[model samples]
Target: MFIDASTNSLTVSHRPTNAPSGLIESLKQYPTANVGDAMDRLNLMDTGIASQWANGRCVGPALTVLTREGDNLAIHRALDDAEPGDVLVINALGGTTRAVFGDLLAEICLAKGIAGVIIDGLTRDRAAIKELGLPVWARGVSPAGPAKYGPGAVSVPVACGGTVVNPGDLITADDDGVAVIPVERAQSVLSRLADIDKFEEDLRVRIRNSAVHAAAPAMASTN
Candidate 1:
C-alpha cells in the first residue's frame, strides 16, 4: 500500500507474484565467470553487463523496470513488487547525469529481501551501499538526485547495459560481470556452468602440476 499525499489517503494494490522456481539459489553456486563460459559454449552473446564494483555478487530472477531519464517512480514501484529472490533490473536509458538509486533505496531493498540491483544508469551513496552490503551493479555514480515523476513500466522487458532483460530472466553478477539466462534455459545453463567449473578446476590442477607447461614447448622455452 502506498500513500497518496495529495488526497491524504492510503492506496492498496496487489503485488505481482514472482516466478516460482528458477533455480536462483543453484545459480549462486557458480561465479559469473563460469556462467559466462557456459553462455559462450551455448553460442550466446551479450550476456555481460559491466559492474562498477568489483567485490559484490548477485544471483536472482530479474524484475525489470524501464524509467525515463532523471525519474525514478518506476524504480519505487518495482521495489514494492519485487520478491525476496528478485533482482531489480532498471534501464534508465543510460542516463548518467543523475542517480536513479542510492543508499536509502538500498536499505529498503535489504529490508524487503531483494537479491540485488542492476542499473544501466548512475547511483549515489556508493560507500553507504557497500557498507550496508547491498549488491549493486551500476555504470557510474553521481551526487545528483532524481525526480519522482515517471512515465515508465514495470515487469516489462528492458535493455540494461547493452543486454535485453525480461522479467523473470535469471541474472547473475560478480566481480567479473553480469550474465543473463533466459528463464526457460536456466536449468540447462546451470548444468553447463557446473561442467565448465569442473573442467576449469581440472585444468588448474594440471597447470599446477607442470603438465600443461610440459605439453607446450614454445611457452616453456619463453620461460
Candidate 2:
C-alpha cells in the first residue's frame, strides 16, 4: 500500500498497527540533543540535518521529498501525500538562497495534522512560523522567495545532510538536532538510546561535585 500524491489519501503497507509504545516513550525521554549523541554512537546513520526553528520537539514518521532546485512543487505534493503522524523531509539540494517553507505552508501543515517539516534549504516567515508553533528545521531562514516550476518526486528516498532518509521512517527533531530511526530498526535503536541516556544521566550526577585537574603540569593554572 502507498499514499497517492494526487489524492492525499493513506494506504497502509500492513494492517494499521499502532506505533511502538516503547518508541513513543523513548522519544519523550531523550530530547533531540541527547538523540544526536546516540546517533553518533550508531555511526550517524540515524539522523537528519535539521536546525531547530521552533519551540517544541518533533517526533513522528517521515514523508520524504525530492524536489528540484529553487522549486517546492514536490514539497507541496508531499504535504498532500503525508499522513497525520508524518514529518515532511525535503531534499532541497542544500539550496539556502530562497525560502522553501513559509507561513502559508506551515498553516496548511498544521491544519492537516503534520508533525513537522525538515528541509535541506531555507525557510521564511519566521514571525508567523513561531507564532503558529509548528516545528520546522532547515539550513537557515531567508527573506528570498522560491520558484514554482516543479519536476519533483514525493515519497522517494532522498539524501538530507549526507544521510539517506526513506519514506515512513521515524524522525525526531528538537533544539539539539534531528535523528532518523529507520522503520525496521526503530525499536532496537530506541532501546539503545534509552540505555545511553541513562548512562549519561548517571555520569552527570557523578560529575556534579568532581573537580577537574590538568594532567599536564605546565597547563595547570597556578595562583
* lDDT (CA) per prediction: 0.77, 0.71
Of the candidates shown, which would achieve the greatest TM-score relative to the real structure? 1
TM-score of each: 0.83, 0.78
Clash count list over all predictions: 0, 0
Q: Tell me the tens digit of each residue's lDDT in model 2 across 114-155.
A: 888888888889778888988888888889977756667777
Question: What TM-score should be assigned to candidate 2?
Answer: 0.78
Please give, for residues 1-223, the per-residue lDDT of candidate 1 as tens digits: 1412121121223434544554777787898767878777332223334565657888888888888887777777767776887888888888979998988888889988988898888899988898899888877899999887777788877788777887888888887777888877778888998888888899899888797667689787889
The runs of at least 3 residues in candidate 2 whose Cα sits more than 4 Å from the true structure, single-residue gaps closed, are 1-22, 40-54, 209-223
Model 1 worst lDDT window (10 residues): 3-12
